[model samples]
Target: MRLCVPRAGDPATATAPVAVEVAAHLLGLVGDPATATVAWDIDWQGPLSVPLTDEHAVQAACGIMHVHGRAAGRPAPLAVDYASTVAGVLAAQGVCAALLARAGGADVTRVRTSVGQAALLALAQYLAAATADGDDPEGCPPSRADAGQELVPAACSFVSADGVCFELEALDAERWLDFWRLLGVDRADTGRGWRSFQQRFATATCALPPVLSATVRRASFTAVRSAADRAGATVLPVRQDPLPPTVTPPWTLTPFPEPGGTTIDRDGTAAAPLEGLRVVESARRVQGPLAGHVLRLLGADVVRIEPPGGDPMRGVPPMAGTTSARFSALNAGKAVTEIDFTTDAGRRAVRDLVSEADVFLHNWAPGKAVRLGLDADDLRAARPGLVYAWASGWGDALGPEPPVGTDYLVQAHSGLAAAVRPADEPPAPSLMTLTDVLGGLVCAQGVLAALLTRLHTGRGARVDSSLFSAAVLVPRGPGRPAATGRPLHTRDGYIALGPRARQRPERLAPALGLAASASADAIASRARTRPTAHWLPRLAAAGVAVTPVCTSLADLARDPRFAPALTVGEYAAPLAPWEFS
Candidate 1:
């Protein structure tokens, strides 16, 4: 699949992940050849070539594997193909964005992305926290991260006396304290545990006091749930349901009452596809902000709409400058305006902003938009060509009174917990906020698709995405056990073998001075006899791709291959995952 770039010095040809490229040309899509899309599992040519597999992507990117391993209390690989799937989704999104750029008279010719980069993007928040300046900010949660261990134990995903393993969520410390106190926990332990649990979404580690887990361990699931209900918290049992026969796409684009009514009037720019476009984003936490950030990366003018005091997360721990590194990672380079949406005047202010904006986005809980008179109908009435987006926890999936639509709860409810880990390990939700990131990407993708659709229809569309939808995309995969796809344990650290080595283990056995055929245990024992450095070159010489497991995200900046994927600033941040070659 050649991506026919028109510009000289641009990529003359590119291929693999053929659907997007094929769709662009076959559908008579016209964009600067510069905006054509191509994707791959990994770069075909690099300083060093690694095998193309989800395992390698996660391990090398310092991605979700580290967080999953921590939650599972071991150096375990996830059973599902998360990185590759996300990469594919992102590739499709790039195609839509490129097409949108063309409609807006922008020259976007060649878009390139890889599973490795997508994996890095998925771990952006953790990467931010890892490279932040100073200790955690004041009033922040207690962090108990241990750099020495391959997997740090997390006090998330509790099991009840009735054998029900479930996820628990509380947005505020007060509710967290109340829930545990109702469960008969000591006030001191609950206080300490709240810090770790509250920050788990930011730091991938939750070292809660053992007493918290113990308290829940002695209670029935019903009793635990009763406490959560009374405290305005939420608890969801880990479901082991079969994959739905039909999974909904993570987001949908729908034209409103009319079509072919509008086209953006701004002049397009050469530097980025979405340049000159304005995105008015009113969002909290990761999902909505992440969607807006994606647009910012694509060169849109993203104006963040915050409450009067500004987002409280500005002070979240591991500060980069004045704001939390995690917040900076998602919202840097975007403009911010504080509007007290609780007042009618604030709603009017947002409406005024929306009057000239290309996109209006939010991630408020269900029905909040309607209650605030900012629903799609309300705002689109003011600006008929507006692309309205809602990035939420659930997209009308669980009805009006849904359980909190947070990432971990969605994971448990959708059986993602079971899908991500082996059967032997108890169902555990990775603290990496996987669904939230994916949902945000889904939201951005939907918005781009809607924008592209508006090119013909001349009307703006409503886009919706949720963590629940994202979770469904990854059903209960028959995950690999802890024994499968494990890295070789060397004296110094671990080194992951590439797809080629795993596929042809017989060849690898001889390189390790083993019999013609080696059992995994024999090879593991032999590999441990030497240091990681000693084994890497020898394995490479024998045609086995290898890389050190990026157990620590702080070290990711030092890996040469990832240089293009990150920028070392006040804190480390992932670059836009796609490359316009």
Candidate 2:
């Protein structure tokens, strides 16, 4: 379902709303009218590309606001006055707060409807505070007044790997209607207030707002389960053990050994633990390339040997000048080279690289490399000490569809879609590349562990990863089979409650007034009954393990704990001036 909100800037100018316009244009591409649902969340910090209208289109949309601070207060004192667009968004927020207070076992009519203009101003003040003193380390967008730039509404169209696309619209201001009124447009052409305008506006933007979807068919889920049953896929379950209350567990963020009493070198280069390591990567897209890239990050001299035309992912979305964002993210910090393995020269070059390399890695089918004469045996023959790693769709080294596998296919074949999608909705594919990223991480771990073994034993070992394996490894619903089981093994399943959910699901269930059968849906439905301010803190303090579902790497880029992954792209110049004295 499409979750969209109207976007407006301080003044609601025609040219300022390009992002929202682009979003609307993309929504126009979905075709059918009856198959979509629009949920609108208005922002109060940017300009708008599309003008607000009073038409029939917007009435059916679910409205929301991009607000800050308590949902109960009138507009708080702020340094600057927000646009009327922001006011409109706050109105929507107030409406929602009223609805939620009623739903969450609170008095309905007596519920304070304090989320009006005054509440919006209060939110603006909190936005200011959050920016100056609050905990938004991830660098969210700035309000127009703070940036000293024209505020325009922005929006984006997101398509999941499984081909489900949706539009998200963000406005810069909540007092949007006031600004429009100040513009003095003719009453002959326009309607009354902002609410009336929005109700009518929905009709013009979309007959039925788009419902973006990324889901798998139940039939596909059943089929894959059947095939896995035949092939013997393993299922691992969740740990239900309770933690001790008195003793605190020690956790370390550092992953490797540090040199004792060693200071930074004059040139600022840290000593490489695996300095002499040389790796040849035949990985193309994110999964395989990410493995090689990780090795490079850890001080291995990795050469990403691509096909004659380079990896196909180079043409994927988010291109920067000459490279795709995906490619840049995966292949950064590694040396890039091309070879046509089908050609004699290309094959010869790879063999030459392999001869000097300590590790040879690729994400290909089981025996295709052997047929192509680049298999482990062939490489081992040329270079005895080379560790070989291969990532596949399935782990057995051979299967019917041993051709190739991507994240989407794995989500379909594995029961992950069954876990993520809503019960009545079709099984939707996940937006995040959990399989690809996890498989890459696993592949790197395998290669490194094998390398350590090689150092001790003087012989190489083969490391393998499967999209199928990665899919099965991530935790799923409580009643489903644990991912650790043998192929086709059935067991009780449970959902992940995040880091804070350490109170044990069984314990938290009673406090939250939920029974064992209370599903994630029930929890989400209840959570929505209160304002974000009230719920987020309460959940955390109560040790309720919850996290946003289906967030992406782009989203994590703003997170402090996980920001390191986003920095991968900044290493384009390996030995740049910043690295030297």
TM-scores for candidates 1 onward, in order: 0.87, 0.45
What do the candidate models score in CA lDDT, each in turn? 0.72, 0.39
Worst 10 residues of 1 by lDDT: 39-48
Off by over 4 Å in 1: 1-58, 72-75, 136-152, 242-246, 259-261, 266-269, 475-483, 500-509, 515-522
Per residue, candidate 1 scores C-alpha lDDT tens digits across 124-216 of 777888788766421133435423322225634888999898889999989999999999888876776666677777766677677877888
lDDT of 2 by residue, 289-352 (tens): 8677656654568988888787776664334446654356557668878998888898889999
Q: What's the CA error at residue 52 for candidate 1, in Å?
A: 5.3
For model 2, state the Cα shift of residue 177 in Å.
46
Root mean square deviation (Cα) for candidate 2 = 24.1
